[model samples]
Target: MSAEFDVRYTAQLARLSLTDAEAAKFQSQLSQVLVYVEKLKQVDVSGVEPTAHSSEMNNVFRADEPRDWFTSKQALSNAPRQANDLFVVTKVIE
Candidate 1:
């Protein structure tokens, strides 16, 4: 289960600098990870169905229905200032 990936090349591509000792250490550690991944490949999952969750799931949403909205007069009735059916605001910039 030897990892054959070029760690130095990978480090260079990732914009990292490593000493020889660090590169050797990482190569060994990465090889161990690959060995575990290879072990997972040996597991039998052919009979298992793929699912996003372990429990039964259902959507909990309310039904959508259209209703009447406030008219322009009703919306502007509470405005501090109004002119020509529009809300009047103070000038903010010169």
Candidate 2:
């Protein structure tokens, strides 16, 4: 079955350049993976529930609420350089 799955042709399809040895190695690895997947099919999953994640997902974000915002002076206090109530970053373009 692994022989039928041509690694060289698949690599070409993906525009990948693989040496003969590399292709052979990948072929063996892919075959082992497929075999494992096939073995998984033999397991009885009738009683198990299908789930997208292994653990429950909940939003980690804090609730949006109106609060006292920073003043312009407070905001610019930590800046290394400031002019006209704005941070003065170094010129990036000529």
Candidate 3:
């Protein structure tokens, strides 16, 4: 990887302002990280299954049972303002 290209491209994408010294330092560090990632790609994983999560978890579920519901008056009892039994707020957009 070209360190100079990497530094210039990253600065442009992030709209960052970096001094000459900082640019050079970042170039070297970024190159090292890319090299390490390239090395990691050489690992073999034949017959290995991919998983979204690491832990062994089954399909967790809850019972579908009816429950008591709250009325609008009870729900908005502590609200600052209400109109027609509903919470009211200031207009958000012009």
Candidate 4:
């Protein structure tokens, strides 16, 4: 299909209203992209395996370890209102 036709069709599908100048601009850009894609098709990759990423990836998380628990007084220090070592807030359920 012609690049101009493809541009107009895509714009229609996307619900975009493009002026003649904008359509022409997008047509030129789309033609360049199609040409680059065609050029890429010429490259040989018979021996290369397809990969999701270009580089090797590994998990970045640190090891989990046990730690001391905070005292109830310390935990409730920042509470706006506390009763019986527990936070008190407006009831959410009706």
Candidate 5:
């Protein structure tokens, strides 16, 4: 990538105000990172399968069962404001 393009892209993404010197430095750093990623592309993985996570996992969900729920009074007891057995919140905008 060109230095000018890299600087513009970084500034746009990060909302940064970089000087020419800082842009030059960042461009060099980004170039190095891209080179490292390119090197990774050269590794052989023809038989390897893609995995979402590194660890082996099994579904651990418990069987759904009916349970007692809190009463309305108990549920709203600690609320700052309640109306008609429901919690009330401030309006966000006019």
Candidate 6:
């Protein structure tokens, strides 16, 4: 596709308003990117595995385990209002 066509089509897709000079600028940049993509397509990758990222990754989160936490009385100690060991707030739904 022509760079002009690509620029105009992309701007339309993104709901962008571009002046003539801005469109021309983007057309040039888009052409360069397309050229680089074409160059990348020529590289040999028969032995390389496809991956989502370039580096090894492992889960960084801690394992889920049971732990002691605040009791009902301690949790409700700072409540502005409470009834029967439960928080009291304005009813949201009619």
Pick by lDDT: which candidate is best? 2
TM-score of each: 0.42, 0.42, 0.41, 0.42, 0.42, 0.45
RMSD of each: 14.6, 10.4, 8.6, 11.4, 7.8, 10.5
Note the residue pairs that clash in candidate 2: none
Over the stretch 1-94, how does candidate 6's per-residue lDDT look in tens digits?
3444578778989999799999889889878887777777778998998898766986678879989999999999999999999999999999
lDDT of every predicted structure (CA atoms): 0.87, 0.88, 0.83, 0.84, 0.80, 0.84
Tell how far residue 27 is off in model 2, in angstroms. 0.6
Clashing pairs in 1: none
Residues 1-94, candidate 4, lDDT per residue (tens digit)? 3343578788999999899999989988888877777776778988988898767886678769977898999999999999998999899999
Candidate 1 residue-wise lDDT, 1-94, digit = tens: 3556778988999999899999999988987787778877778999888898878877768779978999999999899999999999889897
Candidate 2, after superposition: displacement of residue 46 in Å?
A: 3.9
Candidate 3: tens digits of C-alpha lDDT, residues 25-89: 98888888877777756778788788989889989999999888988889999999999988899
Report the error of model 6 at residue 49, Å: 2.7
Top of the candidates by TM-score: 6
The clash numbers for all candidates, in the given order, read: 0, 0, 0, 0, 0, 0
Q: Which of the two candidates, 1 or 2, achieves a greater lDDT against the reference?
A: 2
The list of candidate 2 runs beyond 4 A from truth reads 1-4, 12-15, 47-49, 58-94
Q: Positional deviation of 5 in candidate 5, in angstroms?
A: 6.7
Error of 5 at 29 (Å): 2.1
